[model samples]
Target: MPDRVYLDWNATTPLRPESRAAMTAAFDLVGNPSSVHAEGRQARRVIEEARESIARVLGAAPRNVVFTSGGTEANVLALSPGLRAPAGPVERLLVSAVEHASVLAGGQFDRKELSTIPVTPSGVVDLERLRAMLAGGPPALVSVMAANNETGALQPISQVAEQVRQAGGILHVDAIQAFGKIPFNVSELGVNLATVSAHKIGGPKGVGALMLGAGIEGPAALLRGGGQERGRRAGTENVSGIAGFGAAVKAAMAALDADLARVGSLRDRLEAGLRQTTGVVVFSSDAPRLPNTTLFAAPGMKAETAVIGFDLAGIAVSSGSACSSGKVQPSHVLEAMGASSALAQGAVRLSLGWSTGPEDVDRCLEAWRKLSLSLLKRSGETELERF
Candidate 1:
């Protein structure tokens, strides 16, 4: 078998060496963080240091960061709605139509009245529609992702936060895919809560954080346990994972400029290679997007078939969102962009990351050229690549 090309960074990133080393070093310690013994104190020190590192990258105070099981848990905790705080009047949940399934399935509010802000054809949130929804009387909680996982379309989160504030609402931005790849400052976004995952940033999986800004409403406990995460989320902290996460965050920041430059160039080259052939369309091409993701479709090509073909060719890609894999459903993100079911079914996403290089994208394009030719033949279209 040939070496596989991994272009599905939106699903998860490979563990970086720094994160691996941190986790290994943490494993040498033998104390519970909650204990008062010397061993416990050492463990606590590691945790606190990791907390500070993560807080620094997010431009948040260390005290305000709450570590959770992962991004899913972080989002679920962030969406908890209650009038526990003195801020007053908390009643609704507004989620962008393109949020991850975790946010959609978090059960933060009554499912009956959950409001969805529509997106334009370009896969951007319809601000006018959002403003109209905000005009109503219920106190709202708005959840918008920093970027779409499939299309890489960047959301106007700062603008969304302003709207939420004007409407007396709280905003939560899921920055899982945007954190390491893009420039992010919590102060600039002005959101009440932001969720970021470790694995998405080359840290270990199973650890993530929810950044709570000042004045955000307190969420009811998602898990009831022996009082962890400062009573916000209750569970034994994955101390090693958190340490790895901190290391990954620092490494990502240090490499951000070089990564952004490399990924942008490689992504453009791959997209251009695909476009050179006929019957190819890039989703959200005209909109601002992350440098590393591309969602494209060819006429009469089903995504499942394309995915299998690419996989057999030693390339890995995704049809829609990785979180919704094996569900046999069309992409909600593409449907929100007004793509027909056929077009949506034909779309596949290729996302690059820190480990990606020019050669990786080149390999992907080569495999794509072969697969596209075979797919065209099977669909009875003229062989565009044969020329």
Candidate 2:
């Protein structure tokens, strides 16, 4: 197979060297973190260090971080009605229309008890609508993502936090896509609950955590029969994966400024080139978004076909969020943003990473140029170089 440029960082990132080394070292441990034996103590230390790393970033105590299988699990666990502090049980749930699928499921809450908070046409949460919802309802659990996986639009979390708090509602932020890419701290953002994933920051998959505020009480466990994670999340830990997550967090945070500056510049250049193409549409261009993401579409283009064209051109992109990547459908996010059905169906996402370079951006633009030109010239059909 030929080497291809990777532009799907929002889906998952390549493992960092530091993370790889940490996982490799963790493999030597022969005991479970729950055990009290000598080997177990070492394993426990690894997990503790990982929790501490995440806690440090979230501005919370290590004891407040609960490990889970992945971002989805962590998000689901955050939806419990009792997952609040010094307050009564939550009677309602409010999730942004553009939230991840896991959050949209409403966890333990019934569908009838849940409501969707709309977003602006530019793909931002509608604060006025959210304010009205919070005011009209009982205590609610408000869920929102720090940055969107498809359009990378940054939510006005600080403002949302203030609104939720004023209405005596709890706030949960799915920070998986924004934690390492931008600044995110549970306390700093006035967030009571926040979840993050490992793979999104150059660590292994199947490992994530839910960071809780100090005032939080017993919200109940998603899994049972084990005493792990302070009895809040039951199950043996993914020792090696947690170690890798910690290492990746440290490395990513340490170099965040440099990565932001460089990757952001490449994205700007890539967008500039894409805009040069006639009839191109960039989603959420006017909104504050993650520095490394761009979702674009062309009139009459079919995203599934465009994705294949990019692949044939030795570049990897996606039609939308990774969860919906291969499916032929309109983007729910774009639809919520009030995009035309045609534009929503044809949108394609290209997300950059710390390892992306100027060469990769130029190559992607070349592929986009060829694909867009052909698709437009044919009035909908796609033609590209064959491998």
Candidate 3:
């Protein structure tokens, strides 16, 4: 087998060395964070330090950060109806049509009580539609992601926050994909709740956070028992995972600017290479997107087939969100963006990371080029074989 290039950072990033070291140190500590003994105090200190670090990175008060099992749980915790913010209690839910499967599942809300706000062809949330939905409903909890996990399309979160505020609705921004890749300030976004996952930012999986903005009360506890996380989430804390998350957050913030520039350039070069091939369409190309992501498709190409081809050519990519990659179906995100089923079925995503370099991009391009040629020949698309 040949060395493989990894271009699926959006699905989950490679763990940072800093995170690994932090986790390793945490693992050697003995004590439950809930205990009052010296060892317990040490464990608790580690958790508090991690909480403070993550809070500083997200521009939130340390007390407002509620650690969770992962992004899905963080999101679920934020969707509770009747949760109080400064405005009032939420009575319903409104989510962007292009939200992740976890968000689209209508967390904590019955199907009849949930409504969807549409997005434009560019994959941006439609403010007008959102306004109309809010107008017709009771105070709603509106959820929109900072960036699409599949296409990296950045939603109008700031604008959406304003709209939700005007409508007296609480806004929850799923920043799981955008947190370390882009500059994210929970206060600046004016969101009541923001979800972030550790693994998406180069920490280990199984740890995430729900950040509550100032003046916003934390949501009802999702898991009630031990009175952990200020009674917001109750469980024996995963000390090592939280330590890794803290380290990853610190490292990610420090290198954010450089990573953005480097990864964005790599993504551009890769996209330019793919565009040189005929019938390649870049999704959300005209919209504001995360610097490290490119979702593209070729006419007549099946995404699964293309993914397999890439793997065979010593490259790694994904057909869509890792959560839904195994399902043999068109992307719900693309469908919500008004993409034809056929085009959606063919879509593939390439997400870059801090470790991605020019050589990795070149290798991905070479593999894709060969795959395109082979597919074209089989389809007898002579006119499209120029690449």
Candidate 4:
């Protein structure tokens, strides 16, 4: 057998060497960042330095970054109500239909009044619908992802943020898929809150950041304990993880353009190769997408079976959102894009990353050909029923 060809970069990336080295160095420092002693000060220095590095890469102020356990906690903390809300009434929570399960399950909003903004077939948000929804009621806090995790569809967050601001509503962007892969300027996006995960960018999995723009205050603490993260998130700082995250962020910023070109080419090759098979339709193919991701469906094939088939062939792939991997439900992202349950059932996602190479892409393509043949033969059908 050969090394596994990982095409699930959209789920998480392998840690970069630079990130690993930084984490190794941080492990030697034995001091609580919250302590006032010399050791504590040293630890604090490490944390702040990491913060500055991350802030520089994201084009945000160092003071605006709040380290969280990961993107889930960050998003939850960002959406929670601060100390100033009036008693009795809950704030409106507007979430896009294609949000990650983390955002959907955070429980930071009211379920009864939960407004879902629709997306176009291209996986872009229907701005006209959003505007109408905004005008239909009092201003509501809007949460939209910068990119669709499954389809790799890029959202018009800057324009959406502008609309939210004009409506006196706050915008929270789940930027887990966008941060290091694409250019992210918090100020330019005009979002009050932004969520980014380290694992998506070749950093440690347990570390993520919630960036808050200047002068904007968010909801109260989801975690109550010793005051950390400037009294926002409460926990002992993840020094090693933060260091790794900072290193990865800096490295990603330096190599983004080149990485984009290389990965984009590989993605194109993968999509084109899959298309040679009959009844293969690539989702979000007509939209602007993350350079390294492709979502496609093999008609008459079961996604679980295809995933297992690819895994057996030494290739790693996903059926839908990684967060919902073990569940049997079809992808909400694809369903939102008007894909019927049957079309959504056969959907597969192949995402590249900084470490992806031509050989990996070729290997994946070869595996797909073998699996599709076996799958179609087993089903005794060449085409899947259209919705």
Backbone clashes (count) for model 4? 4
Q: All models: lDDT?
A: 0.86, 0.89, 0.89, 0.84
Using TM-score, give the best candidate's number: 3
The TM-score of predicted model 2 comes to 0.96
Clashing pairs in 4: 80-219, 81-219, 81-220, 82-219
lDDT of 1 by residue, 255-324 (tens): 9999999899999999999997787899999999999999999887888889999998888899862335
Per-residue lDDT of 92-143 in model 4, one digit per residue for the tens?
7778889987777634765765788999988999998998887756557788
Stretches of model 3 off by over 4 angstroms after superposition: 85-87, 321-327
Q: What TM-score, computed on C-alpha atoms, does each candidate reach?
A: 0.96, 0.96, 0.97, 0.94
lDDT of 4: 0.84
Evaluate model 1: give its lDDT.
0.86
Clashing pairs in 3: none
